[model samples]
Target: MFYGDKLTELRELNGLSRKDLADKLSVSEQAVWQYESDKVTPRIDVLNALRDLMEVDTSFLFEPNMVTRGVASEGHIAYRADDRKSRKKTRTELTYLRYVEAFVDYFEGFLTQEERSIDSLRSMTKQQADKIQYAGSQREQNLEIENLAEVSRNYLGIQSNRDLMYKIENSGVCVVERNLGQEIDAYSTISKSGRSYIVLGTHKKSAVCRNFDIAHELGHLLMHQHQNIELLTNEEYKEIELQANRFAGAFLLPGAEFACGFATLARKSNPDYYVDLKSQYLVSIAAMGHRAYDLGLLDYQEYRYFSGRMNTLHYRKLEPLDDKIVPIRPGKLRALMEFVLKSRLTSVDHIRSLFHVRPQFLINLFGIDQHFFDQFEHEKHSYYGGAKVIRMPGA
Candidate 1:
């Protein structure tokens, strides 16, 4: 039977409407609606057109379970979109995430069966907040954030900024970097199967900024998982963002250690004085300055002076050593692909066939270049009798 839900999902994934698909198919809008409503099955020509347009095999239309393998309710996504443009972007991102969840589900079948564990800070934060008779005070919230940061660090076994990204991946969070356009910075979402995803923008020039973006998304994953972010008012959204910022700050630069290090600085307001700390902590100059202010190491006047000086130097837009410091890239997905290829478990073409997408789609989705897939394509071979063999010359 034709799967109407799959057709609807693919159309929406591609950001198309009934009219749009109908126009593309040279049919009436009602015909497209009928196809999606399961009132009528599309003709073979239309089915082939859909297969080409959606980048899926024609047989996928008949497979009712293909798209629904890992699909949960759309309500599971907790995205940050404050404007119309951002809402549109969020829809596109959510669509991509559905595909990613499916991919992960398909890939997991090839791996060893190990129990995946995820720590939810939301429940912990709530329990602590209840124990403290929590009023919605900023100071109390900050204290809780600081405590959670410490707990997260300890739980993940992260010793320093160097191990932070690795710990996140090891904890089973999928991190991806892509060009999300200029409208948004980054976003995170959780799947019904407890899979966490953080998508970062690739356009961030500074490694410090990229790190901050990742940490911010991590904050959302840990603190606000399963929350309906779309219903938040602007003020409420701002508060959530502020909490995530504080989480990132505390996570990157812990309280006592960072304070001890900052106390050693010769001049508190000098941007150059923070260069070594920036190199060590992988935090932006602005963030370090704010940390100094927040910790009372720099008084209002000193912080204002430093802020003015940084503005005068125009370091906010592009900081020093940005080009030299390499930004962190995601490795979990790449490592999985490498393991599969190196182990001879599968080829790139086979993976593409499983996903029912083109090679370019995988390249864009996985944040990899063409050469990465091209190498596998060059080595692709057919299997016969459960083994790939080369015919030998007759002796």
Candidate 2:
């Protein structure tokens, strides 16, 4: 029997209405609706056309489990883009997220389960919810956020700025890097099984900016999990963003440590003085300036003067050492794929067939190159060695 819901999901994922699909299939709109409603199944030719149109195998329409396991409603995606025109781009990203979930599900099946305890966003939220609820004033809320950041840092054992990505991955959060278009900086979502995913934009060249993006998304995962972001009002969304920004700031630069460092600055209002702090904290100069103001080291007037000077120097667009620091790239997923292939537990072809997606889709989603999948062909190349060829006695 054909699955109607699966067909409908595919059509919507492709941004096609019934009429659009019908036109592509050279059939009546009602016929397309009937097929999606399970009143009638598509013919062989129509199935082929759908397979081509959707870029999926024909069996995917009949076997829903072959593609995705859950509905989009089961997940909560928080996009970083604020423009209304990015709705289509958001949908495309959601599709990519679904595929990511599928890949994680399939890849984890081959690994042995361990009993190690790891702190996750959900667990932390439950532990801290009451404190957040009872907080009356904005000052109390800020204090709570700072406390949460301190607890989170200690929980993850992040002693310094080095190897931050590894600590996040070890905490069971799936971090992925991809080209999320120019508009989107990053996003976070929680799966039905409560798996956390944070996707970083590949367009960001500065490691400091990417680190801030990760920390911001981490804030969303810890504070706003399971919230339907699409239904949130503009004001509500802005408040949520503000909370995340505060979380990121405190998490990256703790109040006591950062304030002590700022007190050593010779010129509090000079942007150049922050270059050393930026290198020490692996955070941007602008962020460090804001942190100083937030920590009360710089008064409002001083912060304004600093901000105006920064704008005049054009430091906000591209700061010092932005080109020097190497951006941290995600590799946990790639390592899993390599282990599976090297151990002969599975092949690339089998994985692609299971997802019913193209190789380029996997390449782009996992941040790997074509050479990763072509390792077998590369191994076939023979190198000429200066050695005497000896014939065996039997030959």
Candidate 3:
């Protein structure tokens, strides 16, 4: 029997509507709806078209959706996208995230998941937020965010600004780099299976920008875990965005240390002076200047002059050392695959059979480059005979 839900999932995952699929199949929109509703099975040609378009095997339509069977929901997604985000785009992104979570869940079954501090961090952040109420004055909320940042920084064991992405991944969060379109920078969410994900965009962003994006999403993951972002008003959403920004600044640059340093080097409003500090802090000059102002290291007039000098120097977009420091990429998933494949625990064919998708589909879905899987092609032997389907508890 064909699974309509599978078709629906693929359609949405591809960011397509029933009408769009119907047009592709040269069928009526009602026909596509019926196929998705399981009221009617698609013809062989239509099925083949779907298999071609969705980049899945024909047998995928009949197989049980292992991805959705274990997972109940995608959970609340907190992203810093444009305010004019379309409903369709949001749906596509969330469904895409759900599929990624399902893939990660599959890979995690064979490995020992060490105890993580992410849960404790979230609990601590929530407790702090409750204590502060965050609904008080601006100064009060900023203080609360600063406290949360410090708490998270300590929990993640970030002594310096180095290896932030690695530390976050070590805390049991699955971070992935993906092209998140033009409007969005990054997003994070907790999956129904109790996994946290942070997706960073590969869109023309500098290394420091990506670091800030990660910290921003971390703020969302910790601070707004309970808020239903989809139901939030525009003003409410803006408030959270501001809070996340403040958290990012505080998290990246601790107030006391940064202020102490800024007082020595930042006597005047010179963007060039920040260039040297940028190398040490690994933060953009604009961000550092903003943090200085927030910390009262720069007076209003001085900060305004600094902003003018920054614009004059054209350091807003691509600053110095932007290209020198390589942007961090997520390696946990790649490392897992390496361990599994290199150890002969599994094969590429076995993975394909499990997912029932083409290699290109997996490549596109994971948002990793094409050449990543090519290296493992030499080890494409069948290991399914020895591989047991381990049924994990609560999975």
Candidate 4:
């Protein structure tokens, strides 16, 4: 009974193009229009494709003003936000102050807009102070940050390590370091469906640094998401950096428990004590030192001493600890790729271009070897053309 024009509207609303709709239908663009214009009634099978692809109730198509309700995920949650400060601000600790100042301004706009919109729609609230969510939807992705602040008891030699890093081994974020001239080694994007946050980091960073950077960005998401004002801005360099530091530390060492752990370790080791702690925590020596300082296990003098020694050891700077090619576990990134490929959301080339990384970067990530590209025609039957592998142009 419904016309194809109605189908077109739904498709557009759900962010689908005619070509995309056609691919899903296994038909031509013109045929799709015929059904919409009521020129011809599609068979039940084509009708089913319309229902599934558009995510609209086909039965409700003839109804008036029927908007497909996006099943409400948890509402947008933002942190005490601040704006980005001046880009010109030098990399000084105090510069972060300006960033926080501007952040206060930008954050308020988003919050006000959120309030007005949510009030118009049927909304529900979840009891959590802060959460990680996709940038587009601002919906919570990780629930652990809700208690990151209050969980630490700061008891004897113990800090409550709140906020969980759900070790999503099957999927993870990666930064794209290209063979090009200059580019930041990392990037972040919210999903179109508001389902997940995608972080692309170059492979140069070690797993620990990559882990910390991702957590740091997650901290920004949780802390500055819904603030009524701008957050640590360009001027508020120190505050922004401090927020990052606290977030990184909070996620990694945990406040109370890490402190207690440090105290217990420090008392036993004394001078060279952090060596034992470093090995135990599986964190960098610098991280160990900073965690000790945060837990009050080391006085300012002790902290200065340990920090200086670690720096001299070149642990955080130009030098690194023993390098071991730890086997890569398919993490959140890989999982997301699989979902995209299976769902036909976008092609593999589209994803690579969206992230602007080396094509080989993603393909090689989940045990997808690159050597097969040498002979696609002759090796069509080989793993290169296997169902498990999806080829994009750049890749």
Best by TM-score: 3
**Each candidate's lDDT (Cα)?**
0.72, 0.75, 0.79, 0.41
Q: Model 3, range 194-302, lDDT digits (tens) per residue?
A: 7788888778988888888989999888887778876888898888888888999999999988887787784557878877778887888899989988988889999
Q: Backbone clashes in each candidate structure, one number apiece? A: 0, 0, 0, 70
**Candidate 4, 320-339: lDDT as tens digits:** 43254231322333333443
TM-score of each: 0.79, 0.79, 0.86, 0.44
TM-score of 1: 0.79
Q: Who wins the lDDT comparison?
A: 3
Clashes of 1: 0
lDDT rank order? 3, 2, 1, 4
Model 3 has an lDDT value of 0.79
lDDT of 2 by residue, 1-395 (tens): 68877777677656577899999999999999899889999999999988877766787777755556452552377766656345556555666667788787676666663422233545755556446536798899888888888888888888887667877776778889877768778888877766778888787659999888888888888877757777788787777778888888999998898988988999999998999999899999898888888888999999999999899999989999999999877766766666556656676677656666656557766777667876732321111122123332321
The residue pairs that clash in candidate 3, if any, are: none
Worst 10 residues of 3 by lDDT: 378-387
lDDT of 4 at 274: 58
What digit string (tens of lDDT, one per residue) describes model 1 on residues 268-325?
A: 9988789899989999999999988887889999999999989998988877877789
